[model samples]
Target: MTMMDALGLIENRSYLSSIVAADTALKAANVTLIDLEIIRGGYVTVKLIGDVGAVKAAVEAAKDAAESFGALISAHVIPRMHEETAKLIEKQKGRPAASPEGAKPTAKQEKEETGEQAKTEAVQEESPSPAATERNEENGQEKLTREQLEKLTVVKLRQLVRERKAMESATQINTAKKAELIHSLLEKMEKKE
Candidate 1:
């Protein structure tokens, strides 16, 4: 019978804890680090692959290490992962290890290094420039009507807020819905008036 490779996973609420777990797992067995997914809202998942015995050992060690940090969410080992499951995992593999010196650049990196910058610039030029807000600034305050503010995209609205010196609320601006962004912009405009 052909032996199948195994997959192990460890999840933690803290990135630091997840890193520690991954390190411990690597040290504990002959497993390979597959990826480290940084989920939204601060959760992180460490993925490892190897023989069943090695993967199980690695996951156990990782779980113990992560639990010591009081941030361990869960840990699991699949003795023989299905091909479809492996494909799904492959699709989510975003955290490839850093390349050693003298390694060739990836296709994506090469494209970015060549034509991506010019393409991005062309697209930006074609869009309505938000530079109008900067030109309308009066005494460090932006003058934008509700209609004008509503017409602007969320990205432009965030930029306007930052230019108006609302640094403390930058995080809120990033996660806010479009309606919230519009409301906040109006409120900031009123405060300046």
Candidate 2:
């Protein structure tokens, strides 16, 4: 696998711990910061991409730093991530950060600041709401088809599973593959029927 093919992930219970982890990871190796996502319940996840050895080293360092705060949840290194998984990470990078204090710029705001309002409008038109993508009217009942489930991103599928409380832990949802997420959601849907 190429140097850029590997992916590293580190999740922590607090934003401060995650920031420290990200900082340590960057200083420890030549990895690129993919994104730092602040999930629900104040949990934070830092993603990195680089050579297999570099990513592994970075994650190890990050894990140690995050653990010092007693906030470390999990850390993993994918030596060669699948193309689809890489695409999902890229898609997530395009999304606006959830903070409302203008700490992070939204895509539209970034475009507008750069005098690209037209492009921003185009992006808004192209991206549909999560609800629209996940559900459809089936005999007047709101249901997600298997095809739709497959079309949904892994992150979205994990959110669906979490919302249903089907999984007992966030780590399970985070570590599950796309197919596993789909299967779990499908099983939950069936149980609801």
Top candidate when judged by lDDT against the true structure? 2
> Candidate 2 has which clashing residue pairs, if any?
none
- Tens digits of per-residue lDDT for model 1, 1-193: 0127798999999999999999999999999998899999999999999999999999999999999999999999988877666656765763222334588978865765568679877656534455655433457555667777777677887887677654357678788887777777677777766
- What does candidate 2's lDDT look like per residue over 49-87, in tens digits? 998999999999999999999999999998887756776
lDDT of each: 0.79, 0.81
User: How many times do residue backbones clash in model 1?
Assistant: 0
**Model 1 worst lDDT run, 10 consecutive residues:** 91-100
Q: What's every prediction's RMSD, in angstroms?
A: 9.4, 16.5
Model 2 Cα RMSD, 1 decimal = 16.5
Error of 1 at 155 (Å): 23
